[model samples]
Target chain A: MIEAIFEKFFQHYNFWAAVVIIFIGIYATIAKNNLFKKLLGLNIFQTGIFLFFISLGDIGSLETLGIGDATPPIIWKPAEERGYLYVNPLPHVLILTGIVVAAATTCVALALLIRIHKEYGTLEEDEIIELEAIRGD
Target chain B: MINTVVEQFPALIVTTGVFSAFTILILGLLSRKICYYIVLIVTAFHFILSIFTLQHVLTKGRIHYWFGGWRPPWGIEYVVDELNAYSLIVILFLGLLGIIFAKRSVEKEIEERKLPTFYTVMQLLISGCCGVVVTGDVFNLFVLAEVASLSTYALIAIAGGKALRASYNYLILGSIAICFYLLGIGFLYAVTGTLNMIDMRIILQNLYENKMVHVGFVLVLVGLGIKAAVFPLHTWQPDAYTYAPSAVTLIMSTVVAKTFVYALIRLIFSVFTVNFLELYINAWNLVPWLMGVAIIVASILAYRQNNIKRMLAYSSIVNVAYIVLGISFFNSQWSLSGALVNILNHAVAKGCAFAAVGAIVYKTGIKDVGALAGLANKMPYTSGALLISMLTLIGIPPSAGFVTKFYLAIGCLEMQNYLMLAIILLGTLLTLAYFLRVIEQLYFREGNSTQKEEVPFSMLAPTMFLAILCLAIGIFWLTGIPLEFLKKSITSMGVIFR
Candidate 1:
């Protein structure tokens, strides 16, 4: 049972790292009072997800039976005759798109923060809520 | 040549709106006056094209347009089946009315120089919604959803009061929701090795027992649940709707929320087939109970709201729960029809209500219910429209809201869930209680001001049109056009109905 547990651990080590990062990020987002930290937490959480996806696409070199040999995915020669395995490239592409989306979200959030600070003179969520309550009064 | 051109209409509808947004930007720099006309022409064209697309999908089969001639699992594609076409028509039709209503409301609310930019972003937002409904590629759906959401954030912040904070909260929470969506797609890709919705469905059938698939399902559910503002995740909605410009509130409450719900339905039914739910997972069994709780909770919260727009926003949560309730009972024809009918019924009724409120605010600048004492005496037409819409929202007979509740009650009966039936009836009473408070203030209580004229023709036209549609749709619902269409859509997605 211990050997099986170790095997499982070794197989999913990247996922375990991702889980830790996700929890840390979520905790920071929920528990932190600063808006900037919340944004950063979101970024960290996204980064962990990107890492998990990229790792899922990474397959090790397969040298047995003269198939899936380690080689770069270039079109220099016929793909079938090269007798080499190419790690799946789709996840990298998806993550690239994700990075762009993340960047756009951060840009918008930062702009909003700048606006909020200019208006409310505070960066903490609780402080802003208090200020809004005062204004309501 | 004509057939080829007709086949391209699905892609054209989205491109037209986006390209016109850019067109409005450049032309606005040249001359501000022409921008409105250009937006009008573009939205009108978009509406016409959407009607043609829906009619074509109904008459013929689905339209599958490959980007750059690439096939599935490789290149992006736009697929317009009956369901997408119906949603497209609804969205574009609302966009048309929203832009028209914005002419007067925007003039009243915004600075003169910012009008062109307002139209530009509005088009971009509409195009983003259109793209979300049309795209067959899941990644593309995420991209378009962000486009819609980011534009929404900008639009909400445009009002520049409490709007700044509201938009910021929405941005943070919305970003988290989109991130979860991306992660869910990543997990699905890991298990299925494909991103095309149809291809993913085929690949997922084999991976139904995989734990990753389950994780993906849960993540996507939570992610979209947040985006659709389902119950506990709906904290960002009330403030965003209350603080945004009235025209923007109209578009967001109607088109934006509807688009996310449509995407959720697509993900649940199209990407993950019903059989997958029955055989591999039982997570769906919890949906009806959750929605029932949401219906009760959201109504009670809405009942307590003093701000009119915020109250409507909370009530939107109630309508969304009803939709989810219908889809949860996926096996029943009544349940599915109830959900589908509510999409149209709720859209029209809510649009009328918000538009009328916008007009009232435009005329009197009041956003409170008690402050509207004797408003019916001054703005009779607008107030009358509000009354009809509020009754429709409260599910009174001879109104669209009633049809939704009737079908849903029958659905509850079909499922033999008498407890849910009682909850729904209780919800109706609560809806009446809140809306009647506003109605009584409008008609009964005395205002200290003299008589006044109604809102301008521009705003009144769309408000009255939608109010009348609310009544027409409810009274004519038994004619079965929407029912037959919804049944066809549900069946076309390969969901079997008993």
Candidate 2:
């Protein structure tokens, strides 16, 4: 049973890796005191999801069908004639959009951080919270 | 099939909003004063288009527009079913009122230089909401939801000072929520390989017991629940509401939150269907219980707040819970209708309440609940609007809030869920307790200021209009005018009314 589980784990190592990276990113986001670090963690978290999505698009070897390594989804005459198994381009498109959204979020967060730093003279979350409490804001 | 002009209305409404955002940005460089007019014209146009869209849907049928003439399963589709059309009208109506009200409020609250950008972002926010409502694609929903949320963050941050922190907190949490929603989308995509909601729904009929599908459903629920500010997931809401500019607060609390709830309802009833919920997923069974806690707990929290906006923010949470609870009684037709009606009811009532509070802050710079003492004498129209809205919120007879509670109670009786019925009544009493505090302060208490200082006519008109709408909608529902439309929309969504 242990060997069977290990075999399955090794077969889907990419998903396991993605999950682990996501948890690490979540931990840093939740536990980090520095606001910049939190933003970095958030980016990391988003990157993990992006990785998961990209992995989902990968069409690995299908020996029974005699399919080899998946090719990029570039539709051309020769590739179509050869009948190459192209990877699903939809998830790639989705992740590209997701990446744009992540970048925008980061830009907004960084702008807010700059304003927060200018106002509070610190990037530490606890320090800022304490300051707010002291000022009764 | 671009056969007719009416078919293009859905795309036109959304594009106009996006186009106007840019127009405002470019034109504002020439003259900032034109930005408000641009938003006003665009929102008014949107409201008109929404009305026509609803009329079309009611008379004809669902209007489906495929992007680039691509087929449904492949390309993004814009659909205006009865529900979407109804939600569009509600959102655009509130949005127009919000824009009308923003003229003086924005000038007063925002910096002079930032006026153009403020109007631009507000336009984008409204368009994003329209996109969310109209789109039939789930991924498109995510993108539009992000657009709306990002614009919301910017609008809140524009308030500066303590608002900066509130906007930042909201940004982080909101991003996380969207990411979870995306993750849910990813899971469903992996399983079903389709992103069109209707297509996915058809494919998911056989896969209801799939573990991944279950996870996807739950993840979507969690993500949207946070966005909708449902009980436990509402940590970022109060701060965002309290610190955002008054216009921002009004739009965000009403239009933005209602759109998210509409999205939740769409996903639950349209995509997942009641069969999925009844057969496999029991997670929804917890919704009513959590909302029960939310109604009581949030009302108590609202009662304890010193800041008037903060109090209203907490009250917003309770109202959100009310909508969710009403809908969560999925078996009962009355409850579903009540939930849908409450969206418009709460939006009108809360929009007026916040507008009144904003007017108070605008003229007097008063934020405390206690400081509202004798406001009725100074700004009689604004205070009177606030009183009417507050009474509506407390579910008094012949008001919109009462209609929702009355329907919801009957819904509970239909389901034989007596406990939820009791909770609904208790929630009303609690709502009465908190809103009564403000009403008493508005009318009964003695204060120093007695000058006649009403807000600008532009602002006061919208506030009074919404307040009047609160009672008008209730009377209309009682007369079965709008309720028939709501029931038609609900039935069209495959929900049967007994």
Candidate 3:
């Protein structure tokens, strides 16, 4: 019964999850005062897309019904042991790469932030920009 | 086995370039001046690959090698036809020249502590460029482009000062450009169901009428145009080139922008047919015309500059316009030839010029073009190289730039595109006007109180070496191996301009 409800809800919820993640990411990036927050937002936004892709890979997870009270992903354990198969593996691979790239990029961004703080004596983006402006003048 | 080896000459050459770049990146970490050795080793390896590839293509024909032997539509591929092989040689040759020049030039601007990091970024940048040229996958191009861009960003930041801000601006704009590219790729993937360009071409040909695909192409064009620093989207380049470490300028000015522009060409001509863009010709026709205007505006802008580096930045903007304008001619033989040869010519000539200018900056700290009085006496070889590169920049006969312009003019004339020819002529005149001013300043003036140090021996040697290449390409055309191959490759190409 729960599985059926999830199947019905998932087809609709997948897009919302992506949209919400993207919104929160953008909001933090643009609206937040802290540079660190903006970076976090960017990560959230990036991960949101990652989730969307994962959701895409899970498009058919609900179709493998009536496995008679077995555990998930029971592949070839003699007849009755079989339950629902796992989602597609390709998006998982792509998302894995994305995660690695994201991690590297975030590390760089954070390092830049730290340098900006050390040089200008602040972690706020606007303050840093202002300091840089004074230096330019 | 021998036949297969011969058949895959182009692929091997490209991969060899890529592999050499990686090797340099790893091994370049050791020792202080070790980066120089790594660059030399890699460039030598790439140079040999270039010769063999060019010879193979000339003798046999088009060389297409599939990755994992999967054929098109289902598998990725790498192609080195006339266009690919030509640009590959241009990219690699200039890359070699750049590394050689950079040995002394880079060591000057870059502090000892940052030297290893500099070489690592350069290797990544070169490999990224090489990958852009050789890859047949559209998405793969975007990935490689970032590989180039991220390193380019870091390299620019090494210069300090407003270098960070400039790099930041570049990062923002570059991020937007890459995102545009990725978004466009997503759209393309949605439509074609394949990332391999040859496969995409097959699918796109069938769906040429699709509106979304048309939009995808425009997105790609815009994205790449920004990356290539074409005209309107070229704001980041001046700052990046001006503020970055001097050797970085040499590499960026000569190769990075040109690689992306060529990738743009590869997409339109090889991945999408002329018929497709033609259907929307009325809409897209402005692309070439805008390029024409960029040629004019950028040259004029070059002439208006105070800083020498900024002037060359604008001048490079003009050079990119020529390459792009060539693309707009569709399959026109003369235009394409002009565009193609200009690519190689500019690489050699501009590389020499930037190195010479950087050497000047290294010696006496003169960035302003107007007040640099009496520099020649103390730094004769450096100034002499400056003069030759200037002459070459002006497309003077027996110079590298001369041969390139000659071919480009022929391209314009063959198409009856007289306005483009006029633009070319005007651009050359403007180039002469700006560059000759520098020559006059250098050779005429005796000395100023501020002009303190003699040019460094390390810096002057490379400048003189590059200046020799500029003169030798024009004066000693018969014996120059690179030039000889250029002529052969241009002739062997199957595409006819008219």
User: Runs in model 1 with CA error above 4 Å?
Assistant: A1-7, A61-70, A74-84, B1-3
The alpha-carbon deviation from the true structure for residue A88 of candidate 1, after best TM-score superposition, in angstroms, is 2.2
Provide TM-scores for the models.
0.95, 0.97, 0.82
Best by TM-score: 2
For model 1, how does the per-residue alpha-carbon lDDT over B1-498 read when each residue is reduced to its tens digit? 135566788788788878989999999998988888888888889888888888888888899888888888898988889889988888888878888898989988999899888889899899999999999989999999998999999899989868988998898888888878888988898778789999999899888999989889888988888898988789899999999999999999999998998898899999998998888777688888899999999998988988999999999999999998988888877887788778888888999999999999999999988799989998999999999999999999978898889888998899898998998898899899899899999999998775787888989999999999989989888666667787898886669864
Worst 10 residues of 3 chain A by lDDT: A62-71
Local distance difference test, per candidate?
0.87, 0.89, 0.72
**Tens-digit lDDT track of model 1 for A49-102:** 888888767654223323344455754556665654566787888889888988
- Error (Å) of candidate 1 at residue A105 is 1.0
lDDT of 2 by residue, B1-498 (tens): 776688899999998899989999999999999999999998999899889888888888889999999998899999889999989998999999998998898898888999999999999999999999999999999999999999999999999888988998888888888888888888899889999998999999989989999888988988888898988999999999999999999999889999999999988888888888888877778888889999999999999999999999999999899889988888888898889889999999999999999888889999988878998999999999999999999999899999999999998899898999999999899988988888888899987978898889999999999999999988988897776787787875666544
Give the DockQ ranking, best first: 2, 1, 3
Ranking by lDDT: 2, 1, 3
Candidate number with the higher TM-score (1 or 2) = 2
Q: List iRMS for all predictions.
A: 1.0, 0.7, 2.6
What tens digits encode model 3's per-residue C-alpha lDDT throughout A1-137? 99988876675576577769867876776687776777787788777767765654563533343323333353445555444345555456656766766676666566666665666677676776778678752
